[model samples]
Target: MPAARSGSTRSRPIRRWCRSISRTTRSSRIVSTRPARCARPRIPISTRSSPTTRAGGCSCARTPIIARAARPPAITAASAPRRTRTRRRRPRMADQNLIENDEPLLVAKSLSKSFGRINACRDVSFSLHPGEVLAIVGESGSGKSTLLQLLSGQLAPSAGHVSYRMRDGVARDLASLGEAERRFLFRTDWGFVHQDPAQGLRMAVSAGANVGERLMAVGWNHYGRIRDTASDWLTRVEIDTARIDDAPRTYSGGMRQRLQIARNLVTEPRLVFMDEPTGGLDVSVQARLLDLLRSLVAELNLAVVIVTHDLAVARLLSHRVMVMKGGRVIETGLTDQVLDDPREPYTQLLVSSILPP
Candidate 1:
């Protein structure tokens, strides 16, 4: 009976061993068939100190391996598509040939104007060459705008003569020209950009018509061509062509200013007069407008005479700057030189006033 008990004990252990092997084989088959279902549970790194943790504890502690498995594939030069290079085109400006000349485009001598006893402008004389930009800068009532008016022939100088070289190569006194001839010159050879868009743009007319009117004045009669030219000018100034038929009154301030610019520039005038072109706009709008104006001025090579109280504007756009105070030019020189090293006390004061405290 003792020997029987020993054999039974041995059989019990062998039966248990067989059962354990069978269970392990079944688990292996299940894991092979369904890996997701049998995937090892993720133990957080915080569970590492727990007594229940077996072997190495938290799998999350192996961050390098986990990160490697989760990482996206690298991009290599061989996988990238080849890019073709093309030459960049330049901005096209109208009337390039007409303005390109050896002689100065416009000459002013002792230009002066007055309103009753007030001297609105006094002895403001400067010559503008082709592709040159001159900025008249000062405080309000300082005769900068008046000087611009006298130069553009919008106001007759009380004394002094403004002379412009004609397209036919004849330099004539602006005051001596016949009224009709002067009107023709104003329409074809000169462009005026006012501080107020309302003053420059026709509020009642469609934006397209405002631009096309200048073309019509120059004898562009074809309906299709005039519309096309107007569209082109609007696009050049960054206005959407969809707004071409809308009136200036329906547009925003910046849009109206851009439209006014398009109207004035459509005829490709040799000379342009601007009075505070970026005035009354928000800072962002002013920056964009100034950038556009700079690009257009460079592309067109148009001689410009601009009046502004903003010295920064003068520095950015002008080749030469004329600083005025009390209706007289106090200092005139290259833009950077005059602004950086002022020879006159008034100019020094003007520059210092705009500097940050």
Candidate 2:
């Protein structure tokens, strides 16, 4: 009985010692743990247009240009793009707005000219309409040429104004333009035929050269056209085409004058100023030239202003006549009425002196 009790007590003591060691180990346990740390990937906001026309990966909606980031630098939310302002467009108007209402192609308003003591022209007012021919007639030294020069923009008027047609087909007050501005008109709009044939034609050059010289003056260099135009003009003016190459030096007075006319007319100038066109030619030749000029003017719808002492030339060529004396216009009327009725004393004298040419 004593031996059995001692063995049971020893087994119980060993079980209790193992249980105590297990409890101490459980209390001393350490738990190793870390907070969650995952990487957030950086995304770029693209503003560049796509290279392909189809815009494969483009994010741009309009023509806004995107700026590149600063070199070797990190970007932040504060460094965003700014917007640009667009310009406001204005409406346009027609050139008719630039011109005064319903003015003639040329208007010489109270135009006066004085070469020192000599009063060449005074208070000369006239208007030239498109397709109309006007003749200014007077005795020698009565300022007809001077008035023509003034209207043609060759000489600036000492007083008054001249208006010439512009690109809009409206007359512009020439007094408003500087010399440089007026040159623009001379380059394109007008032509002049001088009283002297020599002044109109270059004597050294051929008749063809004389005719085609205007084309050259206006910057035309095409040889075939120049040749054809010159030849055609020669034929039109009744000059023989075989004589087209001959110089004015070789030509008679009438031929020289005809050449001069052909030279001025070939350009088909809108407004032409002629000084005594049929001055020296015989009656038959004068009639021929006048007929030719009339046909050409009608065909081309040309406007002309002629300064002449020849009443016959005025009657033949012009629709209207302005009689000037002592630097003033004495009478102005339709050509037939002025010639036949003779309102002014000077007109009567001129009509009486004509001798029924």
Candidate 3:
């Protein structure tokens, strides 16, 4: 009986232990199914993620949950607009001032330049309104280039004066502006595209730098913003953005010219001067460039003064045509009137010379 009692006592303790373990297992399963409460310190509701957390600790502490919530949304097309919209940035001056002021944007009065008894330009008078494109057409030595230089302040006119309307609705003579003001105007308000890209682009620098330099000159110091702006202009000129890091010297003739255009247009200049921009290019390249120029001019409402010997280019790009001969404007009128129905004999001969393609 004593042995049986001892065995029974031992069996009772084992059975008690087994019952306690079973109770613990069942309780744990119930607790898990009922959703374990978070043991982490309470944070702001905004910082909190979904309430569904694992047992023992909060996942927020292990992972950067707060940072993920605080992060900005991804940049999508709807959220971020294209850089081309930058053209509209000067609406206050371009739209309001242009409307309030009825005067022409640019005016030249009897502009003449003489180089040692040789007259380059004589009695050149014209006015350019906002968003107008004027084409100067003539043979090689028609003084178109000289006239352009005088209008752009690259040369001092021997006889006449050039006046430009400022954003403040005041007309000021080009000569009246100080050197610093002229430089600022050139950087901000004017763009010059040479026939030769080498004359316009810095051959040693990257294409992006060539474009960004103008922005820098105008106090753009943010590296990221400058890069984005340069990239946008390059794309507008149909240049592959992948080649932005390449130097201008590495680019082809057409690409160099396009890069030059992008460089000039990045600052969104009010006035652009082009000297045979499509000169010496392949026929296809010239056509493509002309189309691009036309679209950009129309889109930006830019005022352009372009010098070209190509009559086709003048017809395609200009609102007004100025015919030059012997350092004088032989004919001047609307592009269609001047080209389709020539009033001057010289212009008639010039038109007849172009065999239809």
- Tens-digit lDDT track of model 3 for 228-345: 9999999999999999999999999999999999988888898999999999999999999999999999888889999999999999999999999989999999999999999999
lDDT of 1 by residue, 34-151 (tens): 1112112243322323333234322222222332233344345776779999987653544445436458889999988889999988887778888899998989999887788788
Which numbered prediction scores highest in TM-score against the true structure?
3
Per-candidate TM-score against the hidden true structure? 0.71, 0.67, 0.73
Q: Candidate 1 deviates by what RMSD? A: 20.5
Could you report the Cα RMSD, in angstroms, for every candidate shown? 20.5, 21.4, 18.3
lDDT of 2 by residue, 1-357 (tens): 011132221111111111111011112231221221211212232223222112221122111212211122333346546657898755333334233324578888888899899899999888877778999999998889889888887888999998887757665787778887766455456777776789877899888888777788778899999999899888888889999888999987778877887787776677888988888778887887788878887887678999999888889889999999989999999999999999888899999997752
Give the alpha-carbon lDDT of every model. Answer: 0.79, 0.72, 0.82
In angstroms, the error of model 1 at 320 is: 0.3
Query: Which runs of model 1 end up more than 4 angstroms from their true locations?
Result: 1-101, 355-357
Model 1: lDDT to the true structure:
0.79
The residue pairs that clash in candidate 1, if any, are none
Q: Per-prediction count of colliding residue pairs?
A: 0, 0, 0
Q: TM-score of the candidate numbered 1?
A: 0.71
RMSD (CA, Å), candidate 3 to true, equals 18.3
